[model samples]
Structures are given as structure tokens and as C-alpha cells.
Target: MQTEKVIEHIVGWLKDYATNAGVNGFVIGISGGIDSAVTSTLCAKTGLDLLCIEMPIHQAASHVTRAQEHISFLKSNFSNVTDIRVDLTPVFEEFKTEVSLDGNQATVDMALANTRARLRMTTLYYYAGLKGLLVAGTGNKVEDFGVGFYTKYGDGGVDLSPIADLMKSEVYELGQFLNVPNSIMKAAPSDGLFGDSRSDEDQIGASYPELEWAMKVIEEGKTISDFEGRKREVLKIYNRYNNSNKHKMDPIPICEIPSDLK
Candidate 1:
């Protein structure tokens, strides 16, 4: 589909979903990444009131700067866009300390990182409830489904995901079509959870482009080795994440009654 058509479809979908659900507006947590930037822009285009939130929890200075920049862009460009920056450092620290006392320690950096994602999720929901808005998610197809790169019940918790079917590469295309700020478009993708700055590729063991390629290849039931050399490494990383994160990607399980019992 053309980029313009994709934008039109997403905008229409958001409007229809909000009207059907009788929600007041769209609420989104902007992370200064291309995906969030695109999603927020799409929501803003729907002409409904939009709340663009910037939630920083022990975030890197660069990430915070980018987020603020995006917020500024939104406020300047969109009349219906309202935004605020909420710092969750104190809340996160208290939660971490309290959980540790209960034998649920945050010893591992990854554990603490996920805690940050969940905290942001909670903050988003809190505002969504107040404003009668639906929480718009920023996840794309590759991260949300192919590798399940999002934090389950954390960033994964959302009322709706507008771009969940778009690949990371496809998201970039939309970003360009939407005229997202070059700072965000050129910046490396990061979850902005950990204190130290690390791109998603650094944590995911493969770049978005590499993973996207691997996912497409595997989806076709073709061997990864068909592409020569280090490309094979993409297959290994892709398979590892695809298999391990199935739990995050799959729907919640429920107990099923036996046929006779039913």
C-alpha cells in the first residue's frame, strides 16, 4: 500500500474505534522514537483530542531530549494535541525498594528495566482513565509479533495498537510520509528503559533490518542459509527471539472444558 493510503487507513480506523467505543480522545506515550512519533501523528490527524505524554523513568539525557523535541513538534503542528512531561523516577525507586523487601528483588538490570516499562504503562492508563481516552500503543509488527520485543503487561498493555501490522522498515516509510522530525527519524531505536543508552539492536542481538529480513524469509518457509555468509547469523537471532517470546505474542490462555463436560 502507498504510504498516504496507510496513513488514511490508520486515521480512519482510530476514529471508528474511538467512536464505536465512545471514548473522548486518544492517549499516547511518546518515546521520541519513529514508531511513537508516527503513531502520535496518526492519532492527531484523526481530529480527535489527543494527549501526548512524555514519561521519563531514569531515562538517558539523549532520550529525554528527543522526547521533548517530539512533544514540541506536536504542540506546534497540531491544534488538538495536548502534552505533559511526567517524571516517574521517584515512583520507580519506591516500587523497586518495596518489591525488593518482599523477596521480589530488582537485582538484574533487565528486571528493573521491565519494571520501568510497566511503570510507564501504569502512568499512561492513569491518564487514559481520567480523560476517557484509549491508550494508543507504539509497537510495530516486527517488534510486537515477530520477536515480541515489547515488555509484556508493560508496553504490551494497551487499548489499541494502530501500527502493529507495520514492519519496522514500513514504519520508517510512514514516518517519512508524516514528515516526522529528522532527529527522530535518524536516531537509533531504543526502549529508553535502562539508564545507560543502548539501541534496540544492542539488546535484541540483531538490527531491525536484519531481523525484518529474517522474519520475511522464515515466513516464506525458506532456509536462512539461502543467503550466504553472516546473514545466517540473522536467522539464529530471529529464531531465538521468535521461539522465546511466543508467550508474549500469543493471546492469554484459558482453561478449556472437556467435550463431555461441556
Candidate 2:
């Protein structure tokens, strides 16, 4: 994949989109993950106002550190880049107090984890609205399309997705080219929603490379009967996520009224 050309294309695309939309620039949540690091860098390269926000809710120390490191790296390299840290721990706690927690422990925990992402999304959009900036998404191909791993109307809600077409491996290639912090490049990929040390692999039960391969084979018209052993297991994991989270991948359902009735 012409990595340099790809980067140039994304940068040019972003700049053109923002200019056409009449927005000053972009505002994105920095999660210290490869996707965010690469996407934010591409935004900065456009020479437009780029706001990197850190919204942490019981976030792991490593995630926080890596996020800050990446923000610092961006600020040093790009004059148009700026950052802010918003600690939402108290806000999250208050929200839990007002909501019903009656459910299966696992289900309740999952809902709250998604809440963290929604809160961060709200924060990003709040600033974007105030500053006339578009909310830039950091999701990649695997998470956004293949597995539907992100929260709907949360991290999935964005004005633009600069890297949604790039696979996870391709995003990493862009990260390396953009000179993202070494700590971020080396850290295990995580959603950081659980506020623990669990990586995305732990939650998905398949590493990105495995999922990427599964996505590729499935796209090529392969089926479960064609593989065995661990290959089958990975395919199963990918299919489960892709099926269950189809709602996130598809457009919201709208009831169409009959023209005669109208």
C-alpha cells in the first residue's frame, strides 16, 4: 500500500472536507491508541486548528501516560496542535448514582463501560460546537466495519472519519510514518473503557492480526467450513461481533410512511 501516498491522500481529504464544510478544524479525543495517534497526526498535518482532548474516566495509568505523551509529541511538532485534559471521573460517578444498576453484573458493567465512551464523545462534541470544529473520528477499518467494536452514538458518532477505511495494520504503518510516540506504538491496543488493564484482544478474544486475516478471508467469500482449529475459533469470534453489532455499522432504522397514507 503506497503508505506515503495514502497519508497524503487522507491529509488532503481532511483539509478539503473541512474547507467545504466551513469548519475551522477538528477536535478529537486522544486515547493513546494507534488509531487516534495516527488520525490526530493527519489532522495536524493539514495546518488547521487541531484540539486533542484527554477525557479520562477511571482510566488506566498507562493509557493516560501514553495519551499525554502523544499530545506532547504533537504539540512539539505542530504549531496548530493544542491539548486539554478533562477528568470525568466525578461526572461518571454522579451519573451512576442517578441510573438504575439492577441487572446482571456483566451486563451492568458493559453498559457502564459504554457510558464512559459516550461521556467522552459528549465532551468532544461540546468543544467542537463551541469552537466551530468538526469532531474527527479515530476508528479504523477493523473496528469500524469488520468487528463493530466501538460504542454506537459514542465513539462511533463523528463528523468525519479520516482513518475508517484503513485497516488496523495500515493505521500502524501510518503511525510509524507520522512518528507517534514509541510508548503508544508499543502499548497493547485497548478501548480503555473498562478502566482496567484488559487489552482489546482480551475483550475480543482475537488479536488484530488474527481479526484482520479473518476479515480478509470472509470478504473473499470464505466460510467457517473452510478452516479448522484456531483459525475456526478466530473466524467465529469475528462473525459473532460482526453480526451482533450490525446495528452500529448500519444506518439507523427509519420507518417509511406510505405515500397514499400521507
Clashes of 2: 0
Residue runs of model 2 more than 4 Å from their true location after superposition: none
Query: Residues 39-154, candidate 1, lDDT per residue (tens digit)?
Result: 99999999898998888887788878888888888889889999988989999888877765443444477788888999899999999999999999999999998999999999
What lDDT score is found at residue 146 in candidate 2?
A: 96
Collision pairs in model 2: none
Instruction: Return the TM-score for candidate 1, rounded to 2 decimals.
Output: 0.94
Candidate 2 residue 158 Cα shift, in angstroms, is: 0.5
Query: What C-alpha lDDT do the candidate models reach, one value each?
Result: 0.90, 0.95
Each prediction's RMSD over C-alphas, in Å, is: 2.0, 0.7
Which 10 consecutive residues of model 2 have the lowest summed lDDT?
174-183
TM-score of structure candidate 2: 0.99
> TM-scores, in order shown?
0.94, 0.99
Supply candidate 1's per-residue lDDT for 42.
96
